[model samples]
Target: MKRRIVMSMFAGATLLASSLLGAAPARSADAPAEFGTDWHDPVTAAPPVAKPSGKSCQVTLAEAQFRDFTPYKGTYTPPEGCGERWSKVVLRMDGKVKGRQFDRLGHLHVGGVEIFRTSTPEPSPDGIEWSVEKDVTRYSDTFRRGQDVEMLIGNVVDDTYTGVIDVKVTLTFYAPSATAARPSATAASPVTNAARPATSTTRSTPTPDPTPDRVLTPDRVLTLQDGTVTTPRNSERIVAEVYATGSGGGCEEFWYLSAPDPAPYSCKAGDGPYREVQIEVDGRLAGIAAPFPHVWTGGWSNPFLWYVTPGPRAFDVKPIEYDLTPFAGLLNDGRPHRVEVSVVGVPEGQSGWSAPVNVLVWQDAKSAHVTGRLTGHKVGELANSSTYTPGSEHRVDTEGRHRLTVGGYVDTSHGRVTTTVSRSLTNTSAHRWTDGENLDALDAAWKDDQSVTVDGRGPARTTRTQRTYTMDGSITIGAGDRLRTVLTLGDRAAVGTTRAGRRIAWSWLDDTVEGDASWTLNVPRDQRHAVGTTSERFRLHGSKGCYDRSLTSVQGVLTEDRRAC
Candidate 1:
């Protein structure tokens, strides 16, 4: 990781003038004949400042095009709660290699701050000591975060490609540095200070540590107690202790076993006035092993204890130097497995063993046959009961006939496990699980099969309700044959277009239909031309969950626009 440089920006006007003056070369007094004349000439000497140097650079992660590579990049749209935001970004640089002289370079720091400068005068024959414009830094400051819209690199040199260069950008979340001697983005003062001489100046401002409590120190071990050991296959024991630290209020300590080989473990010490400690194993509560009443000094000592369990699987615990009988419960069939490890009082949650530990245990391809009732199943749901004779034939008990009857409710949420079936599938009508289908067991099924793979870990579905509608009889208009209209859909029902080809005017029977909900329309009116009558028509288009055809069951004379469209 590259260290970041937090440049504390100073007042600009004075520094700009000073930089311009410093760029001029100095003339020797002996060589100049008119040295005593007007000093306000164009040949005035520039201020002597430290020479700036740099090398090639690269970025770690390719920034999102919306974040870095475009005009609107890095511009944050302030949310409702935000008013004024301040930040100090640290520019980190690393992986520098020597480059040829007089080459223009463009480099960006890890903090996304860019510095592009070029040599004004050509370099000497030795490829060094090239003079450059002091105006670079002054001009660079004008490039605000939101203003930069383009980037171009110029003047490449060969030797500069030696190694890699890394820059780190550390952005202060909401506020600028308070201890900085310059103008901060906080509440500005009425008076501003003048700029100092532009040179290599070190401004040491304190920064807040991101992980203050993460630092841990090992103190004296007051007492080490190996707690009551459990049987070698199951069960576990826990231990607890108390330690005194100068800083109080619930600190965590990581523990590791010292016997055989050192393995790391962790437990918590409580917030103190008086620090109390506790530990648990396999979810079983243990005894307090530290902060005993027998105290000899004013300070406290940390308690130490361990839980001994039988090892895993058929592997045997070798006879060691110490008491092997105490940890017999940990000696089981030797196959590494997941074990829960936790520490109390620390906000950091459980940190289990990084690596699984294998223990010897009895070996067998154990198989269990169990049967349960399939109640509360929906009609047409299937269930199977078959005896598994591994690697042999499967005997279907009662011919594996188990189907949900008319009134029984079936839940696809809790998966239907057909143990005898060769393929795993939610929709049995779909392909087999081995054929690109995601397979899930009982209690691990999704409420809806359409859930995305990532969210399929849980089961839940959307609730659906049915709507009902009924159409009223037709009404008469002018002349022609009377329109024989039948109610296609009831009130409040989403009506689909029953017919197509001819445009018809339709709307909801009432004025309240909206969205893709429901509608009523005009079919065909009568054929009266005494005053030149016009008929209304409704149009229909294909939409989600809707048919493409149109329907105008009854007709009405065009008076004006209907309330529903």
Candidate 2:
């Protein structure tokens, strides 16, 4: 990624003065600042710090050795003074290649939490250096005094290769004063949901009620043998409920195995976090559930502990959820709409990770009343595709109101997903303003729900996930005299499950888990600068088995704690 350079506010004035006086431009009042220390040699032992230069630091490996598929670990600690300066921290990796062969992946961790991951350096031309930088300011709370930091690199090749690669890790910090001019969105206030009891049972198959405006349940179950379904009748508030589970033979298995030539990997089935599921409607893409992991299941195995347990073990089940509400309009036509589920990016025969899916659609008395189609659909590599039809646009002449609703699917590498967006504006001629035009008021809201089922290739090896979000805001323009705006995110939730076979081994529900945010912007008549402030708070609560963890952050401060089930 390329870095952007920002000139100070006085740059224009300084340049103009220098041009008129024919002398060098005078330096601005602000001075340059540096915060962390740097390292200059290989890190083979403790006290990873080399020459400590107050605010900048570095760690080097002169002759790092890595066997194929094996990972190497290194550790470092930031200076205590670097705390609370969240906006000024950056991690950089500079690799100098002595041999032409290098294929690996790099990861950085704080305490025990993984913060960054990247592919190994591409083989560079002789005499050229390869380097990458990452902003670590979001994790400022993890860099407290006396904390242990770990870095791991894995050689991803299938065969062993030996070479010299001079690697340097640098931590750069800037003074607080230097960051004052930058505008930032504030974090949202935290919201917490009560924990549910840990209980396991067979899948719930609820029947739809006959009431016109009540919540409707699925009357049928769709499995691998019954993947397609047609609506029994027309309905409103339609939703396709999906449940999926992942089995063995997944990427997490590939990354952690290390023995017996073709080593057998052992870990809980729900440990692998990157499984993705895609949902298709009537042959068109609908939604996706991407990498909803069971963070609290103790399913994850430590790579550094591979020597202790070297073979495959019996696995358990975990389940995830997905919401297909964006496609409700399309499914309400009382037509036999075909729905298909598949795992994204998992090659056939590589892992026995199969995803078994159960889809249920609910309806009401207003069935067969809604109509829509997938339109202007486009797909590209990874993050480059979009699926959706333009929605209805309405104008109310009496009230001078304009409204629009758009919904559709998006096919990306993560999975094929769906979303719905809406907006409205009201114009009033009640007040006089500075300009000739009448003052107008605007309010808009957008929402999206996405889900997917990932096929792990094995019988019953699958996972499903669902996430929904809503944002609404208001804006007022007073004939160019002053402008005011406020935006709020009302709801955000993600819940998922992983199954081993017929039962749920692990499941989790995270709603806005961290925080919600809102922003307000105001500009006075003839003012040179607009005033803006963002308020935000973050909190995430998750549970698996009898263990639970919650993380909360206010403004820029973060706190994390855990409890046993």
Best candidate, TM-score = 2
Rate residue 115 of model 1 by lDDT.
26
Residue-by-residue lDDT tens digits, candidate 1, 42-161? 110111122323221221211211111122123222222212222221111111112222211222221222222111111212221211122112111222223322222122234532
- TM for candidate 2 is 0.28
Alpha carbon lDDT of each predicted model: 0.17, 0.30
**Can you write out model 2's per-residue Cα lDDT over 1-565, one digit (the tens) per residue?**
0000100000000000000001111222221121011111111000011111245433331124443333345555555454445334555565554323333333444454344443332231232244444444434545543345555454433333333444556566543554354321110001111112112111122211111111222333233335655553433223443323332223332221111111111211221112345567777665444322211101121111111110111010112334444565566555566777765434444453334344443333332343434433343223311111121311111112223333544232223333442322222211111121112111222222322222222332222222333223333343333334343332233333333444332233322221222212233212312332222222222332222222222221222222223
Name the runs in model 2 displaced over 4 angstroms. Answer: 1-225, 249-275, 294-322, 326-335, 366-370, 375-565
Candidate 1 residue 350 Cα shift, in angstroms, is 70
In model 2, which range of ten residues has the least summed lDDT?
Answer: 12-21
